[model samples]
Target: MSIASAIVLFMVIWFMTFLIVIPFRIDTQGDLGEIVPGTHAGSPQNHHLKKKAWITTGITLVLWVIIGGTIVSGVISVRDIDLFGRMGPEGSMWHSESGSAAE
Candidate 1:
C-alpha cells in the first residue's frame, strides 16, 4: 500500500483499539463508593491513561503488523469479498469484465 494508505490504516486500528481498551479495568467513582460532590459517580476515579496508552500502542503495533502484512502481501484482496460478483475478474480494480459497473 502507499504511505498514506498505510498511515490511515494504522490510525484506524489505533483508535479502534483505544476505544475498545478504554472500558476495561475501569474504576468508576460509583464502584468505589466515593462520589465527588459536583461530578457524576460514574466518572472514572483514576483513568490511568498513560498506562492504558502504552498498552494500546503495543496491541495496535502487533495488530497493524499482522493486518498490514496481509494487505501488503495481497493474501486477501477486494475480489475475495465481492459477494455479488462485483470485480468480475482478479486484476480489475474498479470495473468488471462484463462491462457492468459495480453496483
Candidate 2:
C-alpha cells in the first residue's frame, strides 16, 4: 500500500479504537427514579463513576493520538510506503521458469 493508504488505514483503526474505548450508560428507570429512588436503590455512585470513566477515556484518547501519530510518521519516513509492496521474482519463489509472472 501507498503512504496515503496507510494513513487512511491508521485513521480507520484509530476511530474504531476510540469507539470501543468509550463507555455507554443506560438508564432502565425513568428520570424520577434516577434523581431520587427508594431505599436500597442506586445512588450518586453511578455519576461519580461516569465522571471518572470520562476522565480516563480522555487520557486514553490523548495517549493514543500521540502514539499513533508517532508510529505513522515513523513508518512513513522509514518505509517510504504505507503498506507492504508486491514481491518480485527474486523475492518470491512462485514465479514461473519464464519469469513472466506479474503482480
Candidate 3:
C-alpha cells in the first residue's frame, strides 16, 4: 500500500485500540465513592489518557507492521478476496474462463 493508505490505516487502528482500552482499569467516581457534586457517578476519576494513548500507539504499530508486511509480501491481495469474480484475468473485468464476456 501507499504511504498515505498506511498512515490512514494506522490512525484508524490507533483510534479503535484507544477506544477499546479506555474502559480498562478505569477508576470511576461511583466505583470509588467520590462522585463529584454535579457530574455523573460513572465519570472516570483517572482516565490515564496519556498512558492509554501510548499503549494504543504501540499496539497499533505492531498490528500495522504485521499487516504491512503481509501486504508487501503478497501474502494477501485484492484478488484473494474477489469472491464474486469481479477481478483478475479470468473474472468479470477481463476474459472469463469460457472466453466470453456475456458470461
Best by lDDT: 1
Regions of candidate 3 where Cα sits further than 4 Å from its true position: 88-103
RMSD of each candidate relative to the true structure: 3.4, 8.3, 3.3
Error of 3 at 14 (Å): 0.8
TM-score of predicted structure 1 = 0.83
Per-residue accuracy of model 2 over 1-103 as CA lDDT, tens digit each: 4678656655665556556644445333353365545644433324345555565566666765666677656744433452553343345656555566565
Give each model a TM-score. 0.83, 0.29, 0.82
Which residue pairs clash within candidate 2?
none
Against the unseen true structure, what C-alpha lDDT does each candidate score?
0.88, 0.54, 0.87
lDDT, candidate 1, 36-80, per-residue tens = 999998999988888888999999999999999999999998778
Tens-place lDDT digits, model 3, residues 1-103: 8999899888998899899998898999999999889999999999999999999999999999998889889989898898987564733465655676665
Give the lDDT of residue 102 in candidate 3.
Answer: 62
Write out the backbone clash pairs for model 1.
none
Ten consecutive residues with minimal summed lDDT in candidate 2? 23-32
The true-versus-predicted C-alpha distance at residue 67 of model 2, in Å, is 1.6
Ordered list by lDDT, greatest first: 1, 3, 2
- Stretches of candidate 2 exceeding 4 Å from the true structure: 1-47, 75-103
State candidate 3's TM-score.
0.82
